[model samples]
Target: MSARPRPLMAALALAAVTSLALGAAPAVAKAPAGDEFAHPDLKKTYEATKKYESEQAAIDDGYVRTDDCVEDPELGGMGYHYVNPDHIGSTDPTKPAAVLYAPDHKTGKRELVALEWVVPNTGQPRPRLFDHDFDGPFDFEPVGPHYSLHAWIFKKNPKGVFTPYNPRVHCTPCTEDHAKPDEPKPAHPKS
Candidate 1:
């Protein structure tokens, strides 16, 4: 014959099973929409670069601004690119080659929107991270052929996290010329 279970133990077991069956599991914290860090690499990258949220801080760390704000008629705007020449070609996810920012329509202040990883094309298979492949072997001029990937960590990109452009990012101060992507891609402005 089986031994009888203790009353307290039986009660606890029943409650636990009931909770599980009724879907009353504990709640977990959720990262908001596109801001969610899907991988540890992304989280690490965000933590490492979050200080750049302040445009001044990014400038102090050697990120030089590009003259023209970037936009794609089809995909949408990518905002202003502030590139760190030192970070180019580095595979470390935390060290993005560029940071993207957009000027607020009213305030005209640049707000950090995204992070970009750029590696010069050296006949390599292609650089990839965060489960996404980099875009383009396009002529990056001066930098020449390169593959780039954008992480829309700071902004909600309806297209995707790794997409090169974001519909939500706008160039409030950008002129019409800079908004068109087809016109021979502009050269990175000399600092």
Candidate 2:
């Protein structure tokens, strides 16, 4: 028998009740069409995020960052993301932390377009980012084995932030204006 024994059952029950209460919360928001930055009371977050000159600056404010060197084969690249260290595994959404995004492929330009709240897995408590039982808004993702939720509080996302991926968000550097350098050209067929 595990040292904790049946404590897991009690913890699970508490999580279930917490999730139910959160589900009844002012429902996850919907992004306005063409206005991906539209979210209620998001202006404050936008303003706060804008103060940071770069991802490093955000990191200076206790934002933990995770970055991938190369771009994802399909999605191209959006530099990296910074999450608040304090809220990494906490369930309090009172001040909902912001997830700063850098879309310049490591060019150092980042934006505050979304908010994220995560719950770490350490016998603390499981998060309730979903509406249905055991189902989460971002069920496939985990932060340090913890559950997480996002809100595009700063930028306008046709795909609501509460949902997994934002449809309107794109790899800015992948655009023709910011195209990759010296890409291989296709050979012409003999006419």
Candidate 3:
């Protein structure tokens, strides 16, 4: 009779211990640090592009080259921002095209996104300049949970006017944090 009671107590004790163990476990771990997603190569790309821009600026004060390397704050520290070159209008500096990414608004996490440059041609070399008739109203799309991609179709010079070429897509995360508070905005916008 005592043995039977002892076994029942042991079972009860085991159940209690199991419950305690599970209860002590955490529901979620903290997000990784900044170094976790550090892309040295991307940083190098940014620096090199900046240097080129500076040199070009020195060459001609009026000469402004559009680059795809702008830092986006909305990505919550996962990727950087870039320009959408396909949207340039007739070499118009005022209407330069670009695409930027950051983090999702709902969750403070970076995501893979992209900006597509839809022009009238295809398969052109890099650094394709845009003209007035350049048919492009680029579309930006998200790639993965933490990467933005870009694709462009440009027109070739000389003969091809409306030929479709260069359908390229590349992905990169927007490693920045651009989130506003969830509170309602005031009647007047803050200066």
Candidate 4:
């Protein structure tokens, strides 16, 4: 068989590198099964937040534990949200406003599940990611009005990554009232 030319191979390699640099690579190439459609931006989110796979890393970096494991009666659970008030309203990938963790039944510990971007609704343009609008502008109790987007980088969500809830996630039924939102922390002023 005739050999392919080196020039052609080089061009193909360059194209692939360029595509990745421009964020045009296929999203979720290594994502869990059923999660291949996740947006390319999710790769960025994952890289930025993976450092917080240990919950303590998150707390040390200013993410406060919300008392609730947020769930929906119909949609499913979003797990426990540890929110960093300072990161709110920011779009920088490294500054996710929240980290989500779900209890691992096998290990009996919380495992990292997702990263969330939250922006207060104060008349600014709504935040967008994963090719979808952040969900809300709904009054979120003490937090007031805001919009949020979730990237399920660590867990597979058959419903799609940007969806606010994850059926795969669950919360242990608390013997007491351990699941409730504390008085909402005000979002930091946008820098």
Candidate 5:
């Protein structure tokens, strides 16, 4: 094979530069085997969410509610979504009502994608895995006074549990259900 053409190389270089300039590249997720549960400080909180790792177990325990799916792009894409349950256990650190799920290609079931930790609002800035560098939305921040952390235990999040988006997660079009008139949505407001 002959060497690549100069024009083709130039086009490829230009495309790479353009994508980086536009911040079009997807974020890398974190490793799935996070031992936050082993942290002495967060032990209880981690234990609290263990059951939620199983979507059905969480639903039966009132940790989730049926028909709570909604359009969310943070996890993967259009088919990805967040589900808020009727109850969240543990007051010590507080657990997230929003459980992220993705449609399973082979099983045709909503498989658990991630679990979030929703801490109470204490009038301070939200939390993050890092200190003060988390500039994303409060609901996804893993640290801070009133913040949240999305733990991608079920799914691999190359960007880590604290990161905002997970490229591995996604949802199917028209898979979401309308929220009840009186029910409030999980506070995943856009920034």
Candidate 6:
């Protein structure tokens, strides 16, 4: 009888422990380390993006009769527009290479989420471009000729409408010399 009660108590204790473990909130995954964009940089970018979004919202509300309609292109294009967040670039790999935190025009709030790099060819008259995507806690590799970084923040509106706010930051121009490090030539911007 004593053994039976002991086993039952043990079983109840095990069940309680299991319930507690299951009920606990899951731990958040840690962001990657050693990435050029660190936590502080990300925070700054997010703030800038939010500011840009607020500016856009003010413009939209003041200038346009309807939120969806554009009043005049000459005054400025209609609808919600987000300005690119300010960003400082660094050659160091451990620091944030670029940061973009923009607000959702519809929601009027800042959302910090993702970053994108756009590379354009200076030699071409047309807008030829290349794009690279990165999430937080990861390293970003510089690629293409004259690459520009654009950071996107995701936000949701009152109606649960989600949109991305994109702010652009220009990086140091990539020249042919960067691609072919062994060769050195004229200092003029790459054609």
TM per model?
0.70, 0.47, 0.18, 0.68, 0.47, 0.22
* Better structure of 1 and 3 per lDDT: 1
Q: After superposition, how far is residue 128 of candidate 3 from its true place, in Å?
A: 10
Name the 10 consecutive residues with the lowest summed lDDT in model 6.
Answer: 161-170
- Give the per-residue lDDT digits (tens) of candidate 4, residues 106-152: 66666778877777789988887667787766554445666777777
What is the C-alpha lDDT profile of model 1 across 13-129, one tens digit per residue? Answer: 332333211112222223445565756688878778877767666766767665456665455677777777788787788888778877666665666788887788899998888
- Model 2 stretches astray by more than 4 angstroms: 1-57, 69-79, 94-98, 104-108, 121-144, 175-191
Model 6 has an lDDT value of 0.26
* Candidate 2 lDDT by residue in tens digits, 75-113: 322223454545555444443443545453444344445
Task: In model 2, state the lDDT of residue 49.
Answer: 52
Ranking by TM-score: 1, 4, 2, 5, 6, 3
Residue 6, candidate 4: C-alpha displacement in angstroms:
59
Backbone clashes for every candidate come to: 0, 5, 36, 0, 20, 8
lDDT by residue for model 3 (1-191), tens: 01011211222233233221111211222222332312233233233222222222212222222222222232111112333333322232222232223333344432222222222222342223232233332222221111111211111112122222111111232222222477442221100
> For model 1, what is the C-alpha lDDT against the true structure?
0.64
Cα-based RMSD of candidate 1? 22.8
lDDT of each: 0.64, 0.41, 0.24, 0.61, 0.40, 0.26
Candidate 5 lDDT, 75-174, residue by residue in tens: 4331222333232222234355455556665556655566554444566555553232232233222222234444555565665644545555544432
Which ranges of candidate 1 are over 4 A from the true structure?
1-35, 173-191
RMSD of each: 22.8, 14.0, 27.1, 18.7, 19.0, 26.2
